[model samples]
Target: MALLSLRGLVKRFGDTVALDHLDLDVAPGEFLTLLGGSGSGKSTLLRVVAGFETAESGAVLLEGRDIAAVPPHARPLNMMFQSYALFPHLSVAGNVAYGLKRDDVPRAERDRRVAEALALVRLQGFERRLPYRLSGGQKQRVALARALVKRPRLLLLDEPLGALDANLRERTGFELRALQRETGAAFIMVTHDQNEALALADRVAVLEAGRLVQAGPPRAVYERPATRFVAGFLGGANVLEGQPDGAGGFDCPGLAATLRAEAPVDRGTAACALRPERITLRPSPLAGANASQGVVEEVAFRGDDSLLLVRAAGGALLRVGHAEEDGAPPPRGSTVHLAWEAAAVVPLRG
Candidate 1:
């Protein structure tokens, strides 16, 4: 059974609907990421689950029991904020033990639990250090320790690693996932970073303007977005308009060749969305599912890979990725061949 469930949750702020009848279910020991853009209601949904915000309608249930009227303090959950939210005056031990102390846990148990939490976050020796006494990464772990010290059934992380540097954030993303699994707690994190959501989530739920647009495994959501917004928002996609050619292929007017839409296409004859990485580039033309020649319009080196924007013969701009080890691709204005398999084309409607 799912550990947490949101049924038709609705929240409004004056004229703005912060959450519009959002429904979702989070499985036990699962790390679910709530992904969205600014003001997309990702945080608002997390707040509702944390008992920090009450929805105007619907119910919030934990273990099949409604928790709508439960106060944040009384709920079996803890939220780790983006800013860490550690007390400057208190030591790491104090901050982590704050919840236990509030609940009047016995002195021995509080000490043991605090120590265990610190160890879990690899901050065992830094218990005496203040929040300002540590680096950004360490501070984040302290905040995580504090949230986990109480062993809450559910853990809410509000952009928990948003403040870390890019390299650190990447490293901590894996670490956070591991810790969540180790603790066997259902973790629901809200973030705007697509990489973070993909790397850390067991499942991802995307929101837009206070509505649940899509929810599924990270790869499923990325490879097969349900809508144009989801396809373009989760990652970079080349959306194209086309119609079925009657031969199990699509004739996209703006592209140089016919393409095939992946099965289960909502509207096989409508628009199609394909990820940039799915398109393959070749120096010479190749006969395949969808093949065309285009000039390299732009080349951007992005650390591990390079993004090549090719203007196809039909005038549509196609984006393709080349590995860093492939060396520099053909310079700008040079013609290149692009091809993608039938499985790469994700059909969409509207």
Candidate 2:
């Protein structure tokens, strides 16, 4: 059995379903991220797990025991919201120690735990500082320390890094993952940022319209998305429709030759999800199993890489990524050849 499991989880607000029979499992000590756009039920799932919102039906199981009936405070879990919710009146250490004091822990023990939590987040000496006195990142650390001080069985993070600037969010993502590893605790985070989910999650659950469209490691979900929604959500994808043959190939028209079935081919109106980065662009025409000839429509400088928007002979626009340099990229209106490995094209169902 998994460490935490939600079976047939369903939540509704009047006629609208916030979660529709959502099923998920988090392994012991795993960092699982529920990723999706707004209104995709990611936050709803986190709220349900944190006991802030109750599901209309289903069960929450921890270590094979049902926790659906347990009160929020009685459960061994802690939630960190996007707002941090640190008390402005209390110092960092005081905020961290509040939970322990409420539970009637000894003064010395409470202080020890608070110090340790602060140290875990590299804010040991900043305990006496007020929330408003700290930087955004520092304040977030204090919130995290407060949550960690309790040593909860599960940590619920709702848009944990959304409040930080881009650079700080990236830095804190690494720290959050490291903290989870060192503490060996289960973390379930909700976020709308696809890159953040891909970077920090051990496994990602992509939710859409209250349903789990796909769930797997970051690579699996990105490279082999199970649904059209999952394919488009992760990043840029060149979606193509083609039929598959028995011997393992799709005789696709206007896209060079047949694409290998890529194992486990689904029949009828199947789609291929190809990432822009996976496709290689060359000046000369190339012949291969998975190659498309197109004319470069635009070349965009994206700092480290160039984004090429090419119009294929089939009239479909293909996005390709290539390294950037001082010299001009493949000139606009130049014929370019695109190729990718047979396995690069992922088969997708509705």
Q: Top lDDT: which candidate number? A: 1
lDDT of each: 0.88, 0.86
Name the weakest run of 10 consecutive residues (lDDT summed) in model 2.
260-269
lDDT of each residue in 127-168, candidate 2, tens digit only: 788888999899889989988999987899988898899999
**For model 2, what is the alpha-carbon lDDT of residue 198?**
94
Native-to-model Cα distance after best TM-score fit, residue 337 in candidate 1, in Å: 1.9
Q: Candidate 1 on 199-283: residue-level lDDT in tens?
A: 8899999999999999999999999898888988988898887777776777787886788766543334477887888887776
Pairs in clash, predicted candidate 2: none
Give the lDDT of residue 253 in candidate 2. Answer: 62
Off by over 4 Å in 2: 245-247, 251-258, 261-269, 325-328
